[model samples]
Target: MTNNTLLLFSRLYHHDSRVFKEFLNQLPNDEQTMPINSTIKFEQQTSANHSVPDGAITQESFKIVIETKLYGQEDIDQIIKHTDSFDGEKNKYLMLINVHQIHEDYKVKIRNKLNEKGTDVQLIDTAFEDIITSFRSVINEYDTEMSMIIDDYEDYCNGANLISIEDRLMRALPVGDTLDHNFKYKLYYAPASRSYNRRHRYLGLYTRKEIKGVGKIELIVDADYYKESKKFKWEVVEGNKDQLTDEVIDNIVQSMFHGEEEFGYQIYKGHRFFIVPEFIETKFEKVSPGGLLGAKYFDLTDYGLVKEELDTQLIAEKLKEETWK
Candidate 1:
């Protein structure tokens, strides 16, 4: 399944090398094994006079052997064996593409094994998500046929479960009296037991049948609030909590206290908080009746509100002005 996807990309590269070069530039190539001014050709299941069959992207002076795994945890022996395919090439590389990020320890093990054999092939580890993001970044919006190809490739990845649909989603939650408060602190809290999909990267603040604000979620922490002591203790359940500082904690505590006082109840006890570095104003009105209940997920890609290279503020601006298609 994964090889077929590579073949598609290889064929696309053959059609237009310029766009493919941009896509390749997005990948992590520290040693710069990819040739700049050489003729490039892509082959699949090619031996190149070797025993082990692997994909090859060859140039005049360099060769990149691609070993793809639908799942992570590749065989070290097989990978090392692939190094034999490079024969007197000025630049040689062994690219490992997987569905998950290859662990650093695993890469170290591969490097150590290669060293034991005195092999000089450079190793490149990347995930399918990175490839998709890179391809999307370089796609020309005016080229309708190229856009269709990308859509088809993305659909295939999504169908194979190689990519998470939620990553392109923006989940909107209804805000009540705490709308201003949420915007003020760039935080939102709810009961820990509340059932909602939490995989989304962007959160939309919905009120009055319209989304008024949005922010990229930076951290999500589960906390236990003690009203008697006026203290809160939290442990990160998702995102980088290392950025969480004492000042941020104080702000969250103050927000919790204000919620308790306004709602006449302990809203902070056993709650999960979603914190963002900053929230930007937006206006995405909903056409459906009965307002938003619970949470609603919008496909930011489908709406053209997001691109891999776009920042949060740009996305907010697009959301504010663009109408849902």
Candidate 2:
């Protein structure tokens, strides 16, 4: 898996070194580690002088030794051994790419060991998600062929489950007469039995075969509506309920009333309510038939929306003008 990922990077670099450099610039690195006017070389499990094992991106002035970890597993001795590969480079780096952040204690130990060896290599820690983000950031600059290659690489990563589905996916729900209420209160409610392939961090409002709005899911509550008492008993199922204030609760009740008036409280006897701080208006059209029969998930990153610093309003605006690929 690690070699496959490194090969993708090498392919991208060979296609256009500038794009590869831009991708690297987006990663967490020092100024000294940045590549300049030097011939770039991509090596896989090969040594500059029979040292260095994993992947590496080398330049005349600097070298970046990459060690990829699929899980959080780290071997201190193995990592220390790679330090010997950095021989008198002006700027040397040991880039640890993992699915999760490396522990601070491990980083401390690595740094201390490097100091002991008097090696000048800088240790940089990043994740697979970061790599995807950086690559996506520069993807728009390339033409169709290059863009397709980038997409293929991303698809490969997705197939390998290197990028988390839950983190990048947005669940789209169909709306009818309650569309206005959903937009007004930024809430959506449905029967608790509605099946979902996976948990999602975002929600999209679908109406007229088009996604009209999008929002970051702030809370999901399991609610039981009582028609006799004209009230609801709810428990937090996904998010922090403590963040739900009196004003928010009132809005939720209002949304429930609107639903009950149209579909009846019985329809919501045991339901799930999804709440968002605000809904950003959008018009993401569904080109295919069978208009959103059930919950549909779309990978937001597939559309080049950076999940880390995602702007709902910006996404909404982009959706209005751009066609879904």
Candidate 3:
């Protein structure tokens, strides 16, 4: 079914306009819990559907006007013109919502115009991506109705291709076991190669986990810091290996297995190990001794690594299950 942005939002507010209050509290530095019994209006107009605001939530203490543009760029003048329409004595705010992208230039231009007009109306810019993030932030506290509403909104965003790849990676972190203590993941948009005309998506796994016996591990997958064409020079940036007088490589290997029963051991020549061309070094890198020098994965396959070849939606679903746990 075709979903209009306004209708989707109406459904959300229909569930409980308190969600709107929750949303306001979620904004940075706007931490006050708004009073209950607020009223929501759709297609708010000066007379009858004239100078209409996309939506608004008004209460005794505050008024919020939201203008949503899902298909095209928003006209900055629309919001600027509405600053005079607010009649309440409470604090007032105007929010501009977009689906595809938010232009930094738009904010600057609006601020400049407001300054010229001596308008004190506060402006807040947000996008569908931001809404999704905010929803995820509080999904744990949502009741059944709120959860369903979130699911529908998320499905609509995905169907519209409005969800960023980084969003998927961030959502997947809790599900993946290979991550480090923080389970952080970052997605990079790579510039066009000599062959392709457009940029491509690349993901980086910054951390991983292992049994206590394995000591420590770090992984960087698909980052520019390590190249497949180049060999990695491994060093003991810390620990007693740097003080070794002889058999440094052997000593490091011994340290890896000492006091622990592990089958795999890494062997290298001298202080440097040359990675082979066949190794490719694309999927994972085990960070060397120092700290976060190189990128690699720890227990990736078992932890649900989402790669290009893997089904992202499936992994996301699985991760969502893990997140609630």
For model 3, give the 10-residue run with minimal summed lDDT: 273-282
Could you tell me the TM-score of candidate 1? 0.55
lDDT of each: 0.76, 0.75, 0.44
Cα-based lDDT at residue 295, candidate 2: 78
Residue pairs that clash (backbone atoms under 3 angstroms), model 1: none
Q: After best superposition, candidate 3 residue 170: deviation in angstroms? A: 17
TM-scores vs. true structure, each candidate: 0.55, 0.50, 0.44
Write candidate 2's Cα lDDT for 40-127 as tens digits.
7777886645446678877888788888876554677778788777666787888888765576656778889888878787887887
Question: How many clashes in each structure?
Answer: 0, 0, 10
- Alpha-carbon shift of residue 267 in model 2 (angstroms): 4.3
Q: lDDT tens digits, residues 1-325, model 3?
A: 1235455556666765766557656653223454446565555433212366766656565666667675444576766776766775367777776653454555678878877877666777767777767765654563876677777788887786565443222211111332221121111111122122111122233333211111111111111212344443444322233333334333333333331233232222222211111110122323344334332222223446645444433433333333111
Q: Which RMSD does model 1 reach against the true structure?
A: 7.8
